[model samples]
Target: MLHLRVVCPAERTEDVLRVLRAAPGATHLVLLRGAALDPVGDVVEAEIAREATDEVLSELCRLGVDHSGGITLETIDTALSDAADRAEEAAPGEGADAVVWEELIARTGEESRLSVTFQAFLTIACLLAAVGAVTNSAITVVGAMVVGPEFGPLAAVAVGLVGRRWDLVRRAAFALVAGFLLATGVTAAATVLAEGVGLFGPGVLDQGAQQVDFVFQVGPFSLIVAMLAGAAGMLAMTSAKSAALVGVFISVTTVPAAGFAAVAAVLGRWDLCGRSLAQLVVNMVGIVLAAWLVLVLRRSGSSVGGRGSRGGRATARREDNGRPLAKG
Candidate 1:
């Protein structure tokens, strides 16, 4: 369930009330007329079922409430009311399976941006993985995996492809490419500096007796693991089951491969460096491809689930026209 707080202009309050009253999945409606001070409007609140949220939000957006007033949606973690149960039953599908597209797009937009924090996390993770590669420590590699933030932009790319938003696709792709290049370059510089302090030997890249050789080794299993991890990561992101992200992080080798490549370059191990580069590319391609496929499947399910609604066709028309279908 979602708790919605809508600020409606004085003249548009009736339209807002009608939208809420018409939605069978909306309950516990409350209205405080002329209560808003800053924007100066009526404050309307209601609890809405997740399955019915998209259409209702689209309607509200079409009414120009977003431009004239405001609408805020919040998840209700614990609503112990019979009204809520009835609302859920009145909705068409399971709440967990529903896709709140506005929310998803907003979230991925923020995550995919090439910001300072993104750069810092990527560089730091790569550096940590480089240390792990030099020491041949599996523990350190896992730690780097847990710290990497590359999944956000990758997931954004998948979302962009599904939504047909080429701008989002371009931004995410640029962020991914530029981020990895910057991280690898920084890691290589760090390796050179560490060697100057006598922390790394010229023979550090020796393949024999290495415990974490898997970091630089690409095989069929690398593609398989990346594909599985990509699907799981998409599920975790969309379903709000964030705990599963830790498992997804540890299952892929992109960060470790980048770190290993950087370290190998510093040590003049061209063979290991080339292999690590290949491993990095393979993992990234596998992940993006798998994520895109998962999104296509989910989007198909959402269309089928919404097909029976009376207003579904109208909503689809609005979406096709690039009109205000839950804009922003």
Candidate 2:
């Protein structure tokens, strides 16, 4: 359920009230008047069910309440009285199946931006990746992948494409590019310094049998794994299965590839550097393609006359038909 708080001019109060009263899922209407302060006129409060939210919001938009006034809608977890009972009866399944794209964008937006938390995560992940490459340990590489904070911007790009929000798309793309360059630069400098101090050697960069596993190898399997991880990552972001997102992070090789490239460059291994760069490209392309596909599927399935919408309406209609008529 959502709690709608509307503040509008006193003159349009009747029109706003009519819109809310006629809305199919609106209940617990509370009207207040004469609270005008600083060009405000009146306020109206109501509780609305989730299924009817789209229609109610659309009506509000049509009424011009959003212009020259204010309308705030906040999700309410609990309520008291018969309205609460009705809300419980009308609630969507487990609250996980519903995809609130706006909310998802907000959450990921907070993560992907160059905030203190983002910088901290990137720094730690890059250091971990550099250490892993120096030691030639796949386990450390995997740990770096899991720790990297690049997934948020990547997912944001996909979501922006589907929603056609160019602002979000631009911001996400900028963040991704900037974050990668920053991480790579930092790791590369660290690698060079470590090598100068005799902590690492040219032997670490050699493509010999001893360090074969550290060499980047791009193949069809790499692309496939990246694509699968990207799709799962989007699902984890949108659905209730968010715990699986960490696994998705570990399954991809983006951060590790960048780290490998930086380290190889420091060790003067051009061949390994080239291969690592290719690996990074392949993984990013695969993940972006997969994320776009997921968004397309979600949009197609949620159209007004599509299966998901129809199913929601059918369920509501069935309940309406069997219920006793209430006095107005």
Candidate 3:
């Protein structure tokens, strides 16, 4: 379930209360008139089922409550009230399958931003992947995959496309491109340092025991695997089934391939570097394409189901052809 706190202007409090009372998925409504000091309005609180969050939020937005006052949403980790259970049962879809779009946009907005922490993780993951490639350590390669922050930007791109947010798409694209270039460049420089210390050699990457050597080899199968992983990753993200992400981390070779290419470049192995670069590019393209496709299908399916269901529009407008009914 989700908890919502709304500050409603005196004139609009009745409208807000009416919307909440009319929603079967809403429960435990509490009204504190003129209690808000910051926004100087009445405070209203309620608990709502996950399946109905979008629709309720859209109604509040349409009532001009968000603009006149404010609306805050939070997850209720544990709700002991029987009303909450009844509210969930009253909703149309499974809680886990529901998509809280406002929450998703907020989460991905933070993840897709090009911040220092994001750059640092990408750089470190690439460096670790580089070591794994040269040392033939599949374990380390998998570790790098798990540590890589590339998925945020990739998912941001997909989510942006689904939400029709061009600004998000541009920011995610910039972050991904700049991040990979930075990480690959830094990893290459680190390889030079490792060579000087006798820790890395040019032939280390060519060793027969290195299963990770395939990171530099591009094939049709690589694209297929990357695309599949991308789809699975998005599904896991949207459905809150995070445990499925471990498989996604291990299934794609993007980070490992980029690391291999970086190391090969520093060693003047242009042939290997070219192949690895191709592999990296192919994997990224495939993953982005697949993720976008998956999100599109999921969004479309949700829209269709929402429109056909009663007492559960899930934020869709009655006359907007499946668009959320938020007023400006």
**Model 1: per-residue Cα lDDT over 1-328, one tens digit each:** 8888899899999999999999989999999999998799999999999878877887787787766887777888889999989999998888877677666665666777788999999999999999898888889998999999999988888887776665667878998889989999999999999999999788977756377888878899999999999999888776667789899899998988998899988889989999999998898888888988887887754532132333334433443444422322
Q: Can you write out model 2's per-residue Cα lDDT over 132-196, one digit (the tens) per residue?
A: 77776778887888898888888877866765555556767887777878888988888878888
Candidate 2, pairs of clashing residues: none
Whole-model alpha-carbon lDDT for candidate 1: 0.81
When 2 and 3 are scored with lDDT, the better candidate is 3
> lDDT per residue, candidate 3, 112-156, as tens digits?
878899999988889988988788888998888888888878887
In model 1, where do residues sit more than 4 Å from their true spots? 207-209, 301-328
- Candidate 1: the clashing residue pairs are none
Please list all clashing residue pairs in model 3, or write none if there are none. Answer: 55-315
Which residues of candidate 2, in runs, are more than 4 Å off? 1-56, 69-82, 91-94, 108-112, 207-215, 301-328
Q: Candidate 2 versus the native: TM-score?
A: 0.75
Best by lDDT: 1
C-alpha local distance difference test of each model: 0.81, 0.69, 0.78
TM-scores, all models, native as reference: 0.88, 0.75, 0.88
Q: Report the Cα lDDT for candidate 2.
A: 0.69
